[model samples]
Target: MPACEITIEKIDFEEPIHIVRITGALDAYSFPDFEIKVRDIFEKSGRNIILDFGKLDYISSAGLGALMGFAKIARQNNGDLIILKPTPKIGSIIDVLGLSKFIKVFWDEKTALNSFVSKAG
Candidate 1:
């Protein structure tokens, strides 16, 4: 089995942001659970989200699609989904796939969270 774990932590910024940290391989086998958890968070909290990719080592096409899907949902609900500190490998994949065009990517967590506030203000 591929090693993957998804954990969400709420960050208490002036405007709260949910940080979903994914670790290990996010491939076909693990993406479903990841998708579900993110959807649930958006449904329950309706807060903006920052996907922390600092610890994420790998991401398959399915994983990328799941993220795009969730970002779409977040946008429709007046929330945003930002990507934070993707590993170089994953960052390249995201760039090649044009995911960054849809979701902004930040090298720093504080910058990513602050982006949401700047947009609203």
Candidate 2:
């Protein structure tokens, strides 16, 4: 399988939210490709994003830093990056790195979507 597979879904609410589904491992090798895709999303004015890690098998420090970078850019645009359904191993790593405090993590899609709405209001 590919080092990483990324799929983006745009949901149009008051402010559009892009759901980016990633699979496989997001490490140093795959981070460049993923970063390229993310730049495309930013070009399209995709500010708010949901990172669906449900199928993600692994993530490296590079991937985690990219997440932080994405979140910062989104936040600058008055939006944010939210994590969805990360695997236990990924969750453990995120917690260990103290990333969860920086980014929001949710198990349910509805809740995650509503979080953006709630932030706007």
Candidate 3:
């Protein structure tokens, strides 16, 4: 198990999006904590979320499954889970799994934030 850190930051956008920065490796070992923190945030407000993968080094199938679960919950509440600035390796994995079809990925933070507004309008 590698060092995994999940930090949740509230971005001051017009709609108030939550940016969850994932660092290090996200595998089965760390998925539990990640899921708890994210679910707590979602339960509090059910706001749109952006998973910032800029510092994330790796992810496993279990990690992806957790994300898919989050995405489903967000959608049910009229919110969404977006992926921001994924590393090339992580990006490839996500693409290969066709996760992009359900979760939107953005290269830029501003773009990802705007997507929430665009969808609401």
Candidate 4:
């Protein structure tokens, strides 16, 4: 199985948004790959990000910490990072740890995408 896989699809908005889908396990060993993928997006000045974690089966504290940092970066750039369709395990951790307050979680893709529009408008 892959340690971690990240696929980005760009959605054209007023400023464009990226839907980043994560699969496999996101642990210490795979954190660098994840960081690279996201850092590249920020480097291009793309801020709106939706992280689809439905296919991700495992995530360590390192992964969560990385996410927090990315969220901050996105927000600082007039955009934000949201979570989409996270599994129950991931959802529970986000809720219990109060990450949900910092990150919005949506089960529907349309709603998640629209949220960025609403924020921008």
Leading candidate by TM-score = 4
Candidate 4 global TM-score: 0.95
Candidate 1: tens digits of C-alpha lDDT, residues 1-121: 4599989998776767899998888888888888788878877865699989998888888778878888888888888998999999989999999888998899998788789888878
Relative to the true structure, candidate 3 has a C-alpha RMSD (angstroms) of 1.3
lDDT of each: 0.86, 0.90, 0.89, 0.90
Tens digits of per-residue lDDT for model 2, 9-65: 999999898899999989888888888888788878888889999999988887898
> Which candidate model has the greater lDDT, 1 or 2?
2
Structural similarity to truth (TM-score) of each candidate: 0.91, 0.93, 0.93, 0.95
Better of 2 and 3 by TM-score: 2
**Model 4, range 3-53, lDDT digits (tens) per residue?**
788899999989899999999989888878888999999999899999999
Candidate 3 clashes between residue pairs 3 or more apart in a chain or in different chains: none
What's the lDDT for residue 59 in model 3?
91
Clash statistics: count for each candidate: 0, 0, 0, 0
What are the per-residue Cα lDDT tens digits for candidate 3 across 28-104? Answer: 78888988988888888856999999999989887897789899999998889999999999999999999999889
Task: Please report the candidate that would top lDDT against the real structure.
Answer: 4
In model 3, where is the ten-residue run with the lowest total lDDT? 8-17
